[model samples]
Target: MQIVHSPLHLRHDGGMELHRGALVPCYEMPARAEYIREALVEAGHALVVPRDFDPEALLAVHDADFVAFLRTAHARWREDGRDGFMLPSGFPARGLRRDRVPSGISGAMGYYAFDAGTPIVEGTWDAAFAAAQCAMTAAALVAEGERSAYALCRPPGHHAGRSVYGGYCFLNNAALAAQQLRERGFGKVALFDVDYHHGNGTQDIFWERDDVLFVSIHGTPETEYPYFLGYADERGAGAGEGFTLNLPLPRGTGWDTYDAALDTALQRIADFGADALVVSLGVDIYEGDPISAFKLGAERFPQLGARLASLGLPTVLVQEGGYAVREIGTNVAGVLGAFGACR
Candidate 1:
C-alpha cells in the first residue's frame, strides 16, 4: 500500500488544548504522524509527499467561508495583537442566530467554532491544508485503481464540520477523500469512521447525500466528548434517510463487542455496494488511551484491519485520533499491515 504524507503536517504545532476543565499540552501532536511514518518505513512501505491541490478541492466538501476563515484565522489573531493560540470563547449553538457572519476575529471565532479544543496555531491552516492534500492524493491513487492507500493526516479530522472547527480538527479529511472519489467517477462511496469519538463533521457533511454512506461506531454520545450527536437513532434525512448508520457502543467496550459492531457496519457497506471505501482509522480505542473509554487490546487491532479487508473494496485509510503516544505507532501499523497482508 502507498502511504501519502507530508512534512507540512508539522506546521500545526498548537501547544495547548482545553480539555476536561484544564489547559493541557495538546494531545494531538506532530509526533503522532512521525511515529506512524517510522512504522510504515520499517515495514517497507514507501511514503510519498502529496502535490498541492487547488482550494476548490477543499471547497467541494467544506463551506468556502469556513475555509477562508481557517486560512486567515492566525493572521487575524495577530492583527488583534493576540499572543497565544486562537481559541473560541463561545459558540452560537442551539437557539442562537448562526446565519449572520461576524466581521471581528473574536466574534468570527465564536460564530465558526463548536468548542475550544481546537486551538489555531500560526501554521494551522498550512498543516490542515497539507493534511487534506494527503487524503486527496491517497484517494486519487485509489481512483487510479490502486487496491488501497493510507493518508497519515495530523490535526486529525472527523471533528471539523462544513462551517465549524473543533476537536483538534480544522478540515474534514476523510470526507474530502470520499468526495474526491465521488468526483473521480465512483458512483457510490462508503465512509466508515472507527474512531472512539463520532465523526460528527463527516456525518454533517454527507448527512444529506445518498452518494456517500457514512457509518460511525463510537462512544455513546450520552457519555462521550461530543455529547450532541452519535445516537443510534440518528439515521440520515431526506434523500439520505437510510444511508447513514450509527452504532454507538458503551464505555469500556473491547474487541468482543467492537467486533460485532464493525461486522454490522461492514455488512451495511457491502449491502450498499459502494465503489470505494474510506476508513477513518483512529487508534484511540486502545485501552491505554488517556482520554477515551474503549478497551481494545493491541492484538485486536489486526482483526479490525482483517475485517475491513474482507470487503475487498478500494480503500483509503485516513489517520484520525490516537492519544497514547507510545503505542500509537504499533497500533496503527497493526491495522495497516494486517489489511495489506490480507489482500
Candidate 2:
C-alpha cells in the first residue's frame, strides 16, 4: 500500500482546547501524524508526498462559505490584533439566528465552529489543505487500481460538517476522498468510519444521496463527544434512506463487542455492493488513549484490519482521531500492515 503524507501538516500546531471546563493542551497535536509516519516507515511502507488539487474538489463536499471562512479566519483574527490560537467563544444554540454570518472575527468563529476544541492558527488553512490533498491522492491511487492506500491526515476530520468545523477537524478528509472516488468513476461507494466518534460531517454530506453509503461504529452519542448524532435511528433521509448504518457501542467496550459491531458494519458494506471503499481509520479505541473511552488492546488492530480486508474492494484509509501519543503509531501501523498483508 502507498502511504500519502505531507510535512505541511506540522503547520497547524494548535495550542489549547476546552475540556472539562478548563483550557487544556490540545490532544490532537501534530505529533500524532509524525508518530504514524515514522512507524509506517519503520514497517517498510513506502511514503509519498501529496500533489496539489483544485479548490473545486473541496467545494464538492464542503460549503463554499465555510471553506472561505476556514481559509481566512486566522488572518481575520490577526486583523483584530489578537495573538495565539483563535478558538470560538460561543456557538449559535437554540433560539439564536443561525442564518447570518457574523461580521466580526469572534462572532464568525462561533458561527462557523461547533466547539472550542478546534483552534485556528496561522498555518491552519495550509496544513488542512495539505491533509485534504493527501486524502485525495490516496483515493486517486485506489481508483487507479491499487488494492488500497493510506492517507495520513492530521487535524482529524469526521466532526467537521458541511459548513461547521470542530473536534480539531477543519476539513472532512474522508468525505473528500469518498467524493473523489465517485468522480473517478466508481458507481457506488461505501464509506465505513471506524473512528471512536461518529463521523457527523461525513454523514451530513451523504445524508441525502444514495450513490455513497455511510456506515459508522462508534461510542454511543448519548455519552460521547459530538453528542448530537450517531444514533442507530439516524438511518439516513430522503433518497438515502436505509443507506446509512450506525452501530453505537457503550462506554468501556472491548474487542469482543467491537469485533461484533465491525462484522455488522462490514456486512452492510458488502450488501451495498459498493464499487470502492473508504475507511475513516481512527485508533483512539486503544485503551491507552487519554481522551477516549474504549478498551481495545494494541494487538487487536491487526484483527480489525483483516476484517476490513475481507470485503475485497478497493479501499482508501484516511487517518482520523487517536490521542495516545506514544501508542498511536503502533496501533495505526498495525492496522495498515495487517490490511496490506491480507490483501
Candidate 3:
C-alpha cells in the first residue's frame, strides 16, 4: 500500500490541552504521525508526499465560515496579544445564543469549538490543511483504481464537525476522502470508523446523505469522551435514515467483543454494496493507550486489517486517534502490512 504523508505536520508541534480539569501536554502531538511514517518506511512501503488540493474539497464536508475561522484563528489570537496557544475559556451551550458568530477571538473560539482540549497554534491551519490533502490524495488513488492506500493524517480528524473543531481535530479528513470518492463517480461509499472514540464529526458531516454510509464502533458515550452523540439510537435523519450504524461497546472490551462489533459493521457495509471504502484507522483501542479504554492487544490489529480486506473493495485508510506514542507505529504498521498481505 502507498502511504501518503507530509512533513508539514511537524509544523503543528507542541501545545497544552485542558484535560482532567488541569492543563496537560497535548496527547495529540506531532510525534504520532512521525512515528507512523517512520514505521511505514521501515516496512518498505513507499511514502508519497500529499498533493496540494483546493479548498473546495474541504467545503464539501465542512462549513465555509468554519474553514475561514480555522485559517485565521491563530493570527487573530496573536493580534489580540495572546502569548500561548489559544483554547476556549467558555462554550456557547444551553441557553446561550449560537445563531451569531462571535466577533472577538475568544468568543469565536468558543463558538467554533465544542471542547477545550484542542488548542490553536500558529501552524495549525497549514498542518491541518496538509493532512486533509493527504487524505484526499489517498482517496484519489483509490478512485483511480488502486486497491488500497493509507493517509497518515495528523492532528487527527473524526471529532470535528461541520462548523465545530475539537478533540484535537480541525478538519474532518475521513469525511473529505469519502466525499472525494463520491465526486469521483463511486456510486456508493462506506466509511467505517474503528477509532476507540466515536467519529461524531464524521457522523455529523454525512448524517443527511445516503450516498455515503457511516458506521462506527466505539466506547459507549455514557463512559467515554465526546459524550453527546454515538448512541445506538442516532440513526441518520431524512434521506439518510438507516444509513448510519453505531456499535457502542463498553470499557474493558477485549478482542472477542470487539471482533463481534467489527463483524456487524463489516456486514452492514457489505449489505450497502459500496463501491469504495474509507477506514478511519485508529489504534487507540490498544491496551497501552493513555486516554482510551479498550483492550485489544497489538497483535489483534493484523486480524482487524485482514477482516477489512475481506470486503475486497477499493479502500482508503485515513489515520485517526492513537495516543500510545511509542507503540503507535508498530500497531499501525501491523494493520497496514496485514491488509497488504491479504490483498
Number of the predicted model whose lDDT against the real structure is largest? 3
Off by over 4 Å in 2: none
Error of 1 at 223 (Å): 0.6
State candidate 2's TM-score. 0.99
Please give each candidate's TM-score: 0.98, 0.99, 0.99
In Å, residue 253's CA in model 2 sits off its true spot by 0.6
| Candidate 1 per-residue C-alpha lDDT over 1-343 given as tens digits, one digit per residue, 9 for 90 to 100 | 9999999989988888889789999999999999988988998999998867999889888999899999998899999898778878877778988889779999999998888778898999999999999999999999998999999998899998998888999999999999999999999999999999999999999989999999999999999978888999989999999999999999999888998998899999999999899999999999999999999999988999999999999999999999999899999999999999999
lDDT measured at residue 205 in model 2 versus the true structure, 0 to 100: 89
Residues 150-221 of candidate 3 have per-residue lDDT tens digits of: 999987999999999999999999999999899998999999999999999999999988999999999999
Could you tell me which residue pairs clash in candidate 2?
Answer: none
Q: Model 2 has how many clashing residue pairs? A: 0
Candidate 1 lDDT: 0.92
Identify the runs in model 1 with alpha carbons over 4 angstroms from their true place: none
Instruction: In angstroms, give how far residue 213 of model 1 lies from its true place.
Output: 0.5
* Of 1 and 3, the candidate ranking higher by lDDT: 3
Poorest stretch of ten by lDDT in candidate 3: 13-22
How well does candidate 2 match the true structure, expressed as C-alpha RMSD? 0.7
